[model samples]
Each structure stands twice: as C-alpha cells, then as structure tokens.
Target chain A: MQLTQFLSRRRAQKAESRSPLFSFLYSRKIAPYLFVSPFILSVLVLYLYPFYSAIQMSFQRVLPGQVFYVGLENYERVMNPIFFRALQNTSIYVVLTVILLTVLPLMLALILNHRLTRWSNFFRAAIFIPALTSVVVAGTIFRLIFGESDQALANQVLSFIGFSPLDWRYEAWTAMFLMVAMATWRWLGVNVIYFLAALQTVNNDLTEAASMDGANALQRFRHVTLPAIKPIIVFLVTITIINGFRMFEESYVLWESSSPGYIGLTVVRYIYREGIQNNALGFGAAVGIILLAIIFVVSMIQLYLTGAFKKEH
Target chain B: MVHGRQDKLISAGLLAILIGFAFLSLFPVLSLLVASLSPASDLMRYGLAPELFFSSFDLENYRVIFGPEGSRYWTWYLNSIIVSSMLIALSLFFSSMVGYALAMYEFPGKRFIFIMVLLVLMIPFEIMMLPLFQLVITLGLIDTYFGTILPLIVAPVAVFFFRQYSLGLPKEVMEAARVDGCTEYGIFFRIMVPLMLPSFAAMAIFQGLISWNNFLWPLLVLRSNDMLTLPIGLATLLTPYGTNYQLLFAGAMLSIVPIVILFLVFQRYFIAGLMSGSVKG
Candidate 1:
C-alpha cells in the first residue's frame, strides 16, 4: 500500500510538469517524421515531380497553355543531324579533356606530395584561385585573352614565339582548342587537391620497401602510388566526363550558342537553344532525357569497372 | 653525401616546374586584374591589351562600378548575399534534420529516402532544369527570391554529408537524453547540434559557394534587372556590340572578392569538406 501510494504521487508530479504541447512534440513515433517531412516534401515537389513531368513532357507537344501527347515524335526529332553533331563534338571533348585532366593533375600532386618545395601550400592556393572564379568570369577573361585582334595576349605570345597569329574563335578546331584550354586551366588545381588528399593516405613505407627492392623511381611510382590513388583517378575521370557533357558555360561564353556554323556548340548548349531560346519545351525535355540516359549508362559502367559496385559485407 | 646531392638537384628541378605551373595558372587572373586597373581611355583605345605595359593604370573603372552608375552592380551583389544566406540557413536546417533522422531513427522508408538522395545527387541541374522551370512557372515564383533559392534549399549533397557524419556520432548520448526525459527535438537541438559544429561549418561554406556561383538557373528565372544575381548581371555586360571591357573586368574582379574572403576564413573546413565529400566515393 505504501509503494502504490508513492508511485501514484510520482506519476501525478510527472504529469503536472509536462506541458501538453511539449508532450505532443516529444512523441518519438511522430517527431522523427516531423523532422524529416521538410526534406521529403522538397524532394517530392522539386525533384520527383519535375523528374516525372520531364518524362511526360517528352511525350507531348507543350505550348504556352496547351499540351497534347505526340508519341515518340520528340525523340525522333532529337535524333536530327544537329543533335548528332552535338553528340559527336561532346564525345571528342570528353575523351581529350578527361585524359589531360587525369594525367596533369596526378603529376602535379605527385610532385607536391614528394615535398619538393617549401611553397607547396602557396602554389596550391594560387592555382586554386581560378577554380573559385565563376565560369562567366573565367570565360570572359579567356575570351579577352584569346581575342580576335593581333594585339590580344595569346596572339602577341604567338607572334613573340615566331608563329603567325591565329583567330582562335573563327575556326572550329581553334575554338575547341580554346575551350579545352580553359577547362584544363580551371579544373587542374581542383583535381590536384583531390590527388593530394588521396596521396596523404598512401602508405609511404610501401614505397620505401619498393625502392629498397631495386625498383627505380618510375617503377616505384607505377607499382606503389598509381594503384593506391586509382580510385580517386577513376572518380576524377567520371566527373570530367560528366562535366564534358555539361560543357555549356565554357563554350557558350567563348562563342555564343549560335557560334559560326555551330562549331563550338555543345549538347547542353543545344538544349538551351532549342528549349529556352526557341520555346520548344517538349524537344528540350527529350534532349534532356537522352543526355540523362548517356550519363546514367556511362556512370554505371564506370562504377562497375572501378569496383565501386562491389558490396561490402 | 652524393645521394643527398642528387635529392637536392631533383627537388630544385621539381620546384622550378611547380613554380612554372603556378605562374601559368595565375597569369589569366593577373591579366584580368590588370585589365580592371587599366585607364578607361587606354581600354577604349588599346582594346584590353594586357601586354601593352605603356598604358597608365587607374581605379576609374572600379570607381564607376561602385559609384552611382553602378547601382545595378550593388543591387545584384545584395541579391546574391540575401539569396545565399537564406539558402545556407534553409539548407542547414532541413538537410541536417533529415540527415539526423536518417542516422538516428529506424522508421519506414529510410532506405528509400537514402536511395532517392543518392539518385538526386547524380542528376545534374541541367537535366532537371526544363521541368523544374515549368514547375517554378506553375508555382508563380518567377522574379522572386524564394523562387531563386527554393529548388536548391534542400541540397542532396548536404543531406548525404550530414548523414555520413552523423553515422559516426555517439548513439549512447541520445539514449541517455531519452532516459533523462529530454524530448527528441530537445536532444537534437541542445545535445546533438553542439556536437555537429564542424559539419555545419563545412556545409555552410559549400552551400555558400554554390549559391554565390549559381548562374544558369538564375539566368533562366530572373528577368528583371533589379532581381538579377551577380553572374547574370555580369553576363549582360558582355553584349555583342560595344562591350564595356573595363567595367566588366572590374565587376568580375569584385565578384570574386566575397568568395575569396569566405575561403580565407574557412579554408581548413573547406579542404576537409572537399576531401571527405570527393574521395569517399
């Protein structure tokens, strides 16, 4: 009887101290959902809904207020010669840029990791400053640097080196070269940072052991460092490819979307022209879907090849 | 001693190469600064020739940009600040909440939500822009700040980062808080939030950078001059006829200042954030 009376008094005290609002809010079963509902709501409205709408829009001819289903017509139109040209151009850019991005930064990171200079941090920071600048800014500066006149900096450098001045944006090849140069300049430092971080985790003792086993410096690097940083390399390559597909700002700023004969046009640039500029929403949706398909397939292949898909038990 | 001699020679060579690369990397940026400083008369006559050292340098371009004629520039900068601050706040609040729930609770649809986050992370903004533009139009958010920031407020990257970080947090403390009659929100706010300072700092920088540098989406939605962000405003300066190279260069240089300041202040967190976010895959 004494224990029961004490328990009842304690329960009454607990109830008196709890506010109704606090009790409602503190419910474990309900609180987690409330905490997470905002994100879930955003995902549904922003991502999932639009994602589904894009697929639906791809099948229909959408006007300002009217929409009608047109069954694969948009996809068929997206396969026109212009789309093919974009696909081919983007593929070329991806291959060349990926190679340069992967190789150059790896070399820079390896040298920095060797502690060759006391100013490594300063150099890293300086190189990374460009990466911070917006593509609009970088593109504008590059345009001026590679401007049309002989007085331009790039042309001046060429004349100084005894080479004739070339109009960089006038020709398709030269314009493409300018795009690649800008991308390499902007992204090299970012990739170097990635490689540097990965290098920090690499086991130095393994390298020393390899050297002691009569391995040359080149052999040691190939055997020790390359394998250790392979995952990062693969990851950077995939990003480079993705960036290559989405190469809008670089090319768009270098030359307008409607550059001379569509020489510098990229896939995303094409989408911008057809969709926003031309008001062909259905067509744009179809192109976006195609681009999505390409990226999804290539990324899955990348993951598989890099063993990124390997299940960890 | 001979081995030491070889090592010194190799180091010297490597240092020279690194220095050369750094010069190459910074040359264009330096040239942009030089262009911004070039006198308006020189820029008008000589046409943005950074190679021409004989031209006089002045801050007249910057003066013009910051002066009365540059009200547009200031407006755009203010818009960016407001948009990015709101973005950082909203993103940090909701993403961290969702991430915390994912990490702590075993509710239904957790795996599905996690997978959705990952899928959304892989889908670049360009792929989603068309339909998203349509949605924004339908919602009548065009020309509004909320429209500019709404779609990106709950960044999948932030959610993933917070979730990964929270998975490492001590679960025992949460259990103890429960036993002490503390509410779930109370534990998260009073206990877990204090523990998650580094993650918050990292996400702040990342989200801040994205919001500040975001261009393509803002360009699409923001039509009015007053509502324009910095990137879009600067992009308009590069018109096809009679481009104002001096003003443009000055504006570009000014645009980089805020981000550089952010980097200088939170560089360690920035590097930590990048390393963890990038190489973890």
Candidate 2:
C-alpha cells in the first residue's frame, strides 16, 4: 500500500513539472491520499503496528520485564488437547452457525416476502434490537433468564411442557447448544436483513410464473426464489463462518471468564488469555498470527467452493 | 390463492412466528427496565411480570444510572461518545480518501488494495486482538482514546461503501472542477464531499454505533476506572452490586439509548446504507 503511495507521489511530482493545467489538474491525485491518509495513519498506528508487535512478542517469552524468542513453541502449546477442545467446539459452531444462518434467514426472508407479512419494517426493527444491545448486556439478560433456578423462564416452560428442568449452561455436552442459542439470537436478524435485501432482486414474475403453473409456495421458493438469493446465501455463509471463528464475547459473557475455563474458548480467545492476561505476549502474538492464517485458509476455501469470486461477470 | 382459509392460516402462522421473535428480541430490554425499577426485595429470580411488559412505570433505576451514585456508568457513556465521535470523524475522512483514490486515480495496485480490503473484511478482531494489544502497549496507547478510535476508523467495509457511492457520482463534475484549477483536496472538500452527503450521513451513524456499542477492546485495553466506556462502566457496575438487578438493567438501558436514538432519527439513511451494503456485496 505504501509503495503505491510513494510511486503516486513521484508521478504527481512528474506531472507538477508539466503545463499548469496538468500540474494543477493532476494534483487531484494527492487528494485521494489526503482523503485516505487519516485512515491509513490510524490503521498504521493502531492496526498495522499492533499486528507487527504481536508477531514479534509471540516469538519471545514474557517474564516480568525480560522477553526472548522461542519461535514455534507457543504454537505447539496452543494446539494442545486442552486448547483443542476450544478448537473442536469452535469448529462445530462454525459449521452449525453457517448452515443455520444461511437456512434460517433464507426461510424467514421468503416467508416475510409474502404480502400478508407486510410488517417487514416492524419485524426487522424488533428482531435487530439484539444486534444493537451490547453482548455483555444481552448475555447477562439471558444468563439471568436461563439461570439454574426454578423460576427461569426456559425451565418453567420446559416443566410446563412435561420435561425435566435442565441445566442449560452448566453441562459439557449441551453447553454448545446454549452458546449456539445466544449466538443465534444475536446474529439471526442480521442475516434476515441481508436476505431481505437480496430478495428484492428476485423478479416477482418468476415466483408468479411458478404460481401460474400450479406451483406451490414451497415449490416456488425451492426453485425460483432460492436460486435468486443463492449468491447472497453464499455470502452469508462466508460471513457466518468468519464470525463463528471470531466468537468470543458471547462465550466470554456466558461462561463468565473461564469458558469451561478456556475449554470451550475460541482459538482467538484462547490466544487472548494466553498472551494478554497470562502475560505470554509473544506466544499470544504467534497464536494470533496462526489464527490469522487459519482464517485466511478457511475463507479462501469458502470463496473457492462457492465460486462466488468467479470472474465470469 | 389455493385455499382462502389455508392462506389465512399460513399468513397468521408467519405473523405469529415474527411476533414471537420480536418478543424474544425485545423481552430482555423490557426485563432490564423492570428489574432496574424494582426495589431490593422485589428483585426476584426469573419470572415474567405483567408490569415489566405492560406498564412504563419506572424511574429509580434510570436515576441511579445517571446520578452521583452511578457516576461510573455515566462516565462510560461519555467516554463512549468521545471515542465513537472520534471514530466517526476519522472513518469519514479515511473512507472519503480511499474512496476518492479508487474512484478517480487508476493506480497500478488498486486491485490489490481492493483485494486486501475484502480479505480484511474477513479478518475479524480475533486475528488482530493480541497483536493490537501488543501494539497498544508499545505505543503507550493502552487506556487512551486513540487506541480505541484509530483502528476502527480504518474499516474496509466503510471504505468500500464510500467507494461505491463515489462511483455513481458524475466524473464530469470533478473534471469541470479540475478545469477551474481546484487542488486535489480542494475539489474533494468543496465538490465531492458535499455531493456525497447521504454517504456521509450513513457513515456517521454506522461508525457512531460501532464506536459507542463496542465492548471487548475497551474491556481489554482500558485499565483505569475513569477511562472506561459505557460497556466497561456497566461491567464495573456489575461487581459492586452484582446482586442489584435493577441497577444492572438501568445501566444496560443507558448504554442502549444513544445508538437507539441515532438509529431512529436517521432511519432512512441507516436503512439505505444497510440495503446498499447488501446490493454492493
């Protein structure tokens, strides 16, 4: 990014030596830099620098003031079984969340596309309210709602419906379900908006044609509407996958710090605990870099699979 | 059309589900409001209350969140406003700059830069979290507003949004300005900037929300109690009287206010930008 800026500056310099028209006109090139410079400067200071520093620190161990390089040792430790539990949980979540995110939103958008369900604005505003509330607040509310108490709404409903009152967040096997519920609550509406927008592009004639030919609503959706929003679904999938890997706040707030005591943690959150809180700054940085690589690989695979990046257009 | 009653049934079914979802999405806020207002003895475990949902009768919790006793929560809101406003200001600049660069100049590495932006869209704070922490420590920016405001300003998503709006703009207008001998930044500020008012407004709301609503980074970097943002302040509030459901609800609602009002007032721009983000994608 910098090299281009330098080259562009030199180009501007060359143009400045020409006729006044060219010099004065081409000076506009500098504006883009000026326009974008604040961001570049901020990112360089806050984003790029921290990114580089973390890598450097990841190589070196931290002990009080002293720090030194140990290379892949941190990576090795981070990949161990205890931490891999978090990885395993994260992997399952990424897959499940991506699929549900794609399907649920597509279905909701289709059902909502009906003229009878014309309160799109109202439903949208309400459903998206969770997205606005802080995860801390949302998690706390739900944690209280789902707390291990007799009056808990979920357990009350469960018992009312004839099932035993269950420990929602305390178990090993069922914990991811609670996590998924919270994750779903926060994100499902986000995709609903995305799908709703994509739905606007589906020609009404297409769905109408299906109905004219004795097609049912489900059939019309499966054949026509689904195909129109297929690309959007793919986009949502990729986003969901990335978001799943980045899941931290919900787990952090829900688990209240330990996260199965880091067992159900994300690779990113795991790195956070190891690097920042534990003061293994270098090891943490290395973990961060590796996590970056994992994300890069996963997303690349997704893009390649979906063929959404096709150059045919 | 197939069967009138069946159609009605399906329609009602869908409505019921949406209504149910709206309740789930909104019930937490209602509960928060109720819990915040209730007295210490009434801070019950977890039962639905008619008053919480039906009545808008509460002021004690609100007072506590903003009163001298709730100074910490109020400070968090102030910090959040400062940080979010700064972020909004910076993102608008960077986005305009990057957008203009991509729009007018045909740089050789433009494609690569665009690609980087796309890839970075996928690069959530998870990958950058630790590195960011280290970066802050090295720069002595930990606990400072700059640390929180700066990184968020360089958002690729916002940059892309700016670029898209800039593309639809008539190039001839800028060309006309060029003929008049306006400098690069001159045309940008006087010409393209004003023309892109809708984009600016959209960005102001989006960036504002991101800054105001953020919690994780603030939780990580900020140390001093005074430096806390609304979310952090709420967390602090959690500890001293963790048992105070009413107080917790009050603080949460306070945190929710700014973004909610912004979202309401700028509904059109916000929705337009949201729809635009999808179409562009």
Candidate 3:
C-alpha cells in the first residue's frame, strides 16, 4: 500500500510537470523542507518551546494560577550564600576533575600507545568496561565501597594495609574526593580512547627526528607528539569542562541530597535539589539559566582559546 | 624501532604503568562482579568489598535477581529495552533525515537549522528538563512511555554525527538517483539509506547506549514502579529505610549486560562512530 502510494505520488509529480502549482510544490527546493519537517517540529516543540519556557519560568513566581511576573527577584535570590557555596563547590570540582581527566588519561594513552602494552585490546576493554555501566550503578557501588562502616570496601582495603578504618564520606574533602574519584574511574577509559585516537595521528617520523637531534623521550613527545594532537587535547578539555559542570548523578546517588555542608552539590545537582526535590520550579529555572550562561561562556572561551572560531582569510 | 636495553626498560615501565591504570580502571567492575557473585550473607557481611575467599562465592545473588520473586526486576529490564529500542529507531530515522537534508541539500533556513542543532548540542539537557517536564505535565503525558521517549527521540548529538557522516557522502549518486525518476523520499530511503549504513550502525550503538543508560528524565517522567527504566528502578532500591543492597548490586550488575554486549558486538563501529563524530567536522 505504501509502495503504491509512493509510486503514485511520484507519478503525479512527473505527470503534473506543466502545472505551476504542482511544479512548485514538487520542486527540489521545497522537497528538502518537507523532508525536514519532522526535525523542525521537534526543534520547535522540544527544544525551542522548552527553552522559551525556561526563560519564561525564570522571570515568573511559578505558583499555579497565581503566577505573576517577578522582575529580577529570582536572579536576586539566586545570589544567596547557598548559591555561592554551590558555585564554589562546583568550580573546585570542575578544576580538579578537569586536571585529573586531562593528565591521567594522556599518560595512560601514552602508555597504551607503546608497543610493549601487550594485549592492548584486552587492556582497553578491561579499562573501558566501567564506561558501559550507568553512573547510578557505579555510584551505588562506590557508596558501598566508600561506606562509613568498617565493612566498606575502601575501609577494608585500608585495614589490609595496616591502617585503621575511617568514614570516607564524613569529611567534606573526602566526600568530595569520593565523588571525584568515582567520576575519574568511570571516565578514565573514555578519555584514554580519545587520546588514543589522537595518538594514532601523531607521526613517528617527527618523533624520530627529534630523537635523532639528541632529544630524550620526554622532550621528543613534548616537541612533536603533543603539538600534533593539540586539537584533540583541546576537544577533550572542552568535553571535560562541560561534563564537570553537569556532575549530578555521582552526588545524587551517593548522598541523595543529604551531603554534608553542601560539599557534593554541583550546579545541576542544585537545580535538581531546588526544582524537583524542593518544589521550587521557578528558582530552579533561574539556576538552570545561570548554569547555561556559565557553560556557554566557558565553552566560548575554550573554543576561542583553541582557535575554533578562527578561519582562513 | 631498534631494540636495546634502554628501549626494553622503557617498554617494561610503560607496560607496568598501563597495567596499573587498567587494574585501577577495572577495580569497580571487578568489585561489582565479585559482590554480585558472592552469597547475600557474605555480601552483607563484607559490604561490597572484594572477598578473596572462594567459599562465599555462589550464584545466589543471580538466582534472587532472576528468580520468580524478581518479577519487578524483569519489568524494569523489559521497560528499559522497550524504551531504548523505540528511542534508537526514532532517533536514527529523524536525526538521519535532518542530517541528510542539512548536509546534502540547499534549502531556505538551512543555516539557521544547522545552527540550532549546534546550539542544542552544546546546551546541557538538565537546564531544559524543568520546563520540558512542565510541558509534559501540560500535555498530560507525565507517566506515559511516549512522554519518556518523545523528547529524547531527536538527540542533537546523533543528529550532529549523522550530519558529519552524511556530509562525506557523494552527492553525485543522490543526483543520479533523482534523475532516474526516483522521488526524494524514495531516493533517500532506498539509495542514501544503504550508503549511510555505517552511520546508522554507529548512531544505533551510540543512541542505544545513551537511551538504555538514561536516568534523569526517565526518573522524572516514569513515576510508577513498572514504568521505571533500569537505572531508576535499581536506584529506587537504595532508599534509606532498610535498603536492599543485595538486590541493588545484583540488578546493577545485570544492567551492564545489554550495553556491554552491544559494545562487544559493535566495538569496531562504536569507536569508529565516536571518532568520526569527534575528530572531524
């Protein structure tokens, strides 16, 4: 039935070649738009409308039927101490995770790139297996591992090493570190894959030339391999920063909106805490807008630094 | 390329470091697997710690997870499969169509559409969820499966990837098909679709992994027990009062199976797809 309809449609287009209306409607210029209607509808409904609603929500009081315009009140209230604390916590988390994600994965990728890493595929699979697991699952396991009790895996390991067991998430630093550690563990392999892909493009000839010029391995890599893969490094940095800002699941799963001193509260976590959990939809919308603005600025800066906007004259 | 004592030493050091990283990377998975295999008594005693004693190892946890009592677990698993499959299919279709039109055609507002896609890709989905939920509530799709799946069907990342892949497709072939009296839809469906199979495979894996592992939206939209996806369902097991850690760990372990199988089966395409989406325009 569909095939016959399609054929008849095609026949109509061909048969009505001289009709101006049919010709215009069947034109290639218009057909692409018709083909793209689904996406257009999706964007309009899903992306555009929701985005407009978020902006609208940010400016209103957000009470049902009593909704009234509140000019800059949400933004003013968003500058409270708690918001600043959340901001500080998020900044610290992003910086720490970005550094770890950058250096460790680069080092691992460098090591994995070495021909001596036998069964590299197996090693890669083993390393990347965690990436397949959901963050909630990993966070659950990590919570158990880093549990406050003596039976926790982390404390058990500590005891094995002749150290006394301690509550891992009691201290703010340790709790924050636990979340970071989980993020690092889950994403290490993914970053390694990124760097490995970049490493494949690094020409050995340049490194060999550097080595022949009396450079050591480190110097050779510094001058040759790093420059060759600069774009990918920049790309990974962008990805890491974006992901760092969006850190929610690690905290949500571990502490579930009950972290001590707001140590584990990321921007998105705060959004969830206020919007869904606290029933402060308007406040969450304001925070969400702020988060979006911060991400946008940071992304633009990263892109600018990487010369992503530069074009050949 | 020359083998020497210094090279051998460096190679050995590299191998050791890589192995160490790999071990650290696999620690959580290894621990999860070990905990899943241990009997519930031992698991509760040890608290997901890696127990070296083989005497405590058993299939009891798996039995409890897949047993007759674990019908809820099966529902969550089945719900995840259904939602993910629908998302993968619809995402592949609409995203590829948008990508194909953007890459291969000249139309009004093309640049604007492409820019929208790029911007959408950059904006985190978290920010939009609040209002999107409002939209969902207004549309009265709050707990419906279609509500959970609709907003996710046209993923910007998948569309971006398909656009990049389709940009590389030879336009001459499409033009030739057009000249051969094939309708545009027919040409795309029969001709361009086959040519873009690699992109389809790659997007399938990418979208499948994402949809299967998606937690936040599904958690917000899916309110009922049977409606919950795997991540949300498994997470609900960790409530403060008498949390069922045994079933949570076991279910969590089981949740890794489909995506792991997908990654293993399409491991080549997965990496290739990601690289293509990342390394180039």
Candidate 4:
C-alpha cells in the first residue's frame, strides 16, 4: 500500500509539474453530470412535464387537434354549486383526518415505546396490518360492514346495545364518520412507527435530569419529550394535511359517483371524476389547482406555527 | 420519566386509554372478520349480532375464498401479485439508478435537481391527478400493468433518502478508484453499489409494501374488470356479491395473506427503513 501510494504521488507530482491544464483534464468535471444525467432525464419526463402540462391543459380547448386558449371560464364554472359542496366536504375530510393522524399515532407511539409493554412487537405488527392490507380489499370489507342491514358490523353492534339498526351509508354524516374511521385505521400504525423512530432520538439525559429535579410525567413530556419530537410532529402534521386532500378511492367505492354530497368524498376524487369520467379536462385541472393552493397555504401555516423556519424550535 | 406506583398507575391508566384507542383501531377489522364468518343462517336466525366471535366460528368463509369460480377472489389475488412484483422490480432498478447518479458525482443544477426532488416529495400526486391521467390516456397506458407501474417508478423520496445515505459515505473510496483510472461508471457500479446493498434492500421492502397496497391510481386507470388489481377488484365484488358476507370476507382474507407473509419476513427492514435511511443494513 505504501509503495503504491508513493509511486502514485510521484507520478501526480510529475504530471502537475509538466502542465496545469493536464492536471485539470485529469480531474475532469464531467463525471458528476454523467452520473446524474439519467435521474435528471427521468424527472423531466415523469414529473416536470406532467406538472407543466396540467397548467397548460387547464387553459386550452382541444377540438380535433387544433387548440384554442380559454382561460378563466374553467375557474368560473368551478365556483358553482357542485364544486362548493366538494370543497366543503374536502375541508371536513382534512380537519377530521388531521386530528386522527396526529393523536392516534402520537398516543400509540407513547404506549408502544414504553418499557413496561411486554407485547409491543406483537401490537406493532398487528397495528401495521391495516396499512399493509390492499386498500381495495379494505374498502370492500368496510362497504360490507356498512351495508344496509343489521348485517353491517357497526349497525349490528349498535342494535345489540338497544339502538335500532341504521343504514350507515344512506345517511351522509354517518358515512363521513365511517370514512374517517377507515382512513384512521389504515394510517395510524405507519404514523406511530415514524413517531416511535423519533422517540428514540429523545435525549434520555434531558428526561433524567428533569426527573431528578422531581418533575412529573406530564411535565417531563411537556418540557422535554414534546419539544424533542417537535420536528416529527411538524412532519406528521404536514403529511396528514396533505393526505387529507389526496383521499379518493374509498369515496368512489362508497358513493359510486361524482355526485353532490359525497360525504366520503375528498378533493382528489373530484379532479379524477372531472378529468376522466366527465371528460371536462380543463375544469378538473382548475379544481386541482385550487386543492394545490390549499395544501401550499396549510404548509405555510405549519411552517409559521412550528417556527422551524426560524431555527428556534 | 420516573413514575412512582401512583404515577405508574396513572400512566398505566393513560396507556390503557391508548390501548382503548388501539382497540378502536382493531375493532372494525375484528368485526369485519366476525361479520364475515357469521353464517347466513345466523344472520337469518338472529340478525347481525354484536358479540360475533363469542357466538360462533366457521370454516365456510375460508372455503369460499379458496374456491376458484366460487368467487372472483382468486383472480384479484393473482392480479395483485403480478402487478406488485413488477412494480417492486421496476422501482428497485430505477430508484437505485437515480440514487447512484445523485450519490456518485456532482454536477450543474445538482442543488436545483435535489430541490426539485424534495418539492416532488412534498407535493402529493392528487394535485396533478387530472393531467397525469390525461397524459396516461395520451400514452395509451390505461388498463395495462405497465400503466400502473410506470408513474410510481420515478419516486423523489427514494432518491432523497438514497442521496442522504450516500453523502455520509467516505469520499476517498470513490476518489481512490478514480485515481486508479477506473471509469466513473465502473467505480460506481463495482464499489458504491455493492456497498449500498442494505439501502437497496431497505427501499425494495418499502416500495413493495406501498405498491402492493396502492389502490387509487390503479382504480382510476384500470377500466376493464379483468385489469382490476386486488383493491379495485375487491371493491367491485362488494357492489354485486357483497350481500353474501362469507364470500366477501373470504375475498378480503385472501388479499391480506401475501401481504401478511411479506410483513412477517421483512418487518425488521420495514421498521428500520421508516426509521432511518442512514442505517447501514
């Protein structure tokens, strides 16, 4: 190793002594670009182009290959009654789901991360099953559970408790609540895993020091644990809000339409139904832009709330 | 963090509350299984009873799920496996290649490219669902397995995680290889990739779980009933045949089996991948 290093060094010195340009040519700059080219090519094709096309298509009218620009009309149409209902439903979905995503997972992390639990691993794997199960099947199963009869699980259970069996999905509010339950079931474990991972990074020293000073459990969590996992909390908050807007499949499964009062509906489903099913491509893109605007606004709110952009907390 | 017996009881009480949350999480699924297995005779006999498990057990549900023409369940099971495996293979190579480019070299727009990837990671695809579906239509990718697999292949999150892991690797290893007149591609392929085995495995497991479970995009694109993936197919089953609880539960059970197996085997890597992209293995 020493001899090889010595020879390489001597050769490099000789090359350097001969010509500076020779050295620059030897240390070529093209390698990085070469290594990174494939990735750049893919991003342009798959991501950047699709995004650009969405904005462009939202304004253009396509008729037998000739295109004409027709802007604000699409947005105007979107401001009508149907879109308003979807927008209202979208807001409700976001608010309800964000709560479930934050609390269920965070609390689950606290429980599962505890040293006192002997069956933590079992619970972890079991809880994760809902997330791992094919969403289609989960949707199918849930649909059956909410079917009109006392045949449905929720109705059956309620009936057994002296309440009459109710048609779960026929009623709008009950259907929305059930949708929230489905979303919560499928995601709680994945979020808990993230929180549990962050929990590991919580400084034992800080917690111990707090306890040594006779601080109680809630005090320690408030002063130490919560602050420590603040970044993860922010991330979870961000994702929950984003996912809220993205929900679609279960709604389509539940309601079977792009109709008014899609209680199980969310914003993404509206776009899919508009663009694909209804063939109103321009109108759908306008709706998508509106959803995007909300997501971006919520993200900024989170950034302001967490103060992470300030580097303080 | 210290808890006296009273505090322990209090925390334990809180933990039980969390357990109650867990039970709430588990209740619907258990009840699904309960309702599915509840015989038509029983529903006909007592109507949907809440205390389902305490009431009875039956193998009829399992039998219905396994029967080929008995339900459309078998077809959905087969479709899910084929499509998910194809996605797993496609993403492993594509993401690794993307990761390799970001890891092994520097270039103009390197920072811009990285930022673009981060932005993509943050912006959920539903925002662009309209145009992307339009694009897929133009490409004639609808109802095809490649259609389902193609969009998710160029994931920005995988690249971000890989770049993070790669940046922490010692630079001199690549430098030494370059000094030896090894082509940059050769150095990356031979040395860096072999060393990144753990990350590759980690990502493969992660993407497999995702692709296996994905429903929304597939639902939008796949029109023919034959092209239906498991979730889409399962949804269709319930619409017509769902009144038969045994067959529906049976179908649900089959969809879960392969995923549960994959999880049991790869749960450790699955857990670790979610935790740290930086972990070596």
* Winner by DockQ: 3
- By TM-score, how accurate is candidate 3? 0.93
Per-residue lDDT of model 1, residues B60-80, tens digit only? 889889789888888999999
Write one digit per residue (lDDT tens) for candidate 4, span B130-244.
6677678889998888888777886776777677678767779877866765555556666788888888777877887777778778887888877777777766655442455
Question: Model 3, which residues run further than 4 Å from truth?
Answer: A1-25, A304-313, B1-3, B41-46, B50-53
For model 1 the local lDDT of residue A74 reads 97
> Model 4, residue B235: displacement in angstroms?
1.9
Q: 2 or 3, which is superior by DockQ?
A: 3
* Ranking of candidates on DockQ, top first: 3, 1, 2, 4
Model with the higher TM-score, candidate 1 or 4: 1
Residue range B203-277, candidate 2, lDDT tens digits: 787677667768778878899988988777666544323664555677776678767776767777766666545
Each prediction's TM-score against the native? 0.93, 0.88, 0.93, 0.87
Two-chain complex of model 4, DockQ on C-alpha atoms against the true structure = 0.35
Off by over 4 Å in 4: A1-28, A63-66, A258-260, B1-15, B34-65, B68-73, B179-181, B240-247, B276-281
lDDT of 4 by residue, A1-313 (tens): 5565565566656665779775654454765665556567766777778778777877865544676789787778778776777778877888998888888789888888876664677777778778876666666656656666765566766877889977677677887876787888888888889988889999999999999999988999999999888888888888788887787866876666543455555677777777777777777887888788888998898789778688552
Interface RMSD of 3: 2.6
Clashing pairs in model 3, backbone N/Cα/C closer than 3 A: none
- Native-to-model Cα distance after best TM-score fit, residue B92 in candidate 3, in Å: 0.3
lDDT tens string, model 3, A53-162? 99999998877767878988999999988888888878888888889999998988887788666778888877887888898888877876776777777888899999
Two-way DockQ contest, 1 vs 3, winner: 3
DockQ of each: 0.52, 0.49, 0.58, 0.35
- Worst 10-residue lDDT window for candidate 3 chain A reads A1-10
lDDT string for model 1 (A1-313, tens) is 4464455445434644688765565578778888889888988888888888888889999987799999999999998888988888788898889999999999888888785566888888877777788888888778778877788788888899999988788887898898888889988988899999999878899988998999998998888888888878878988898888888888766665467877788888888888899999899989999998998898888788888788753
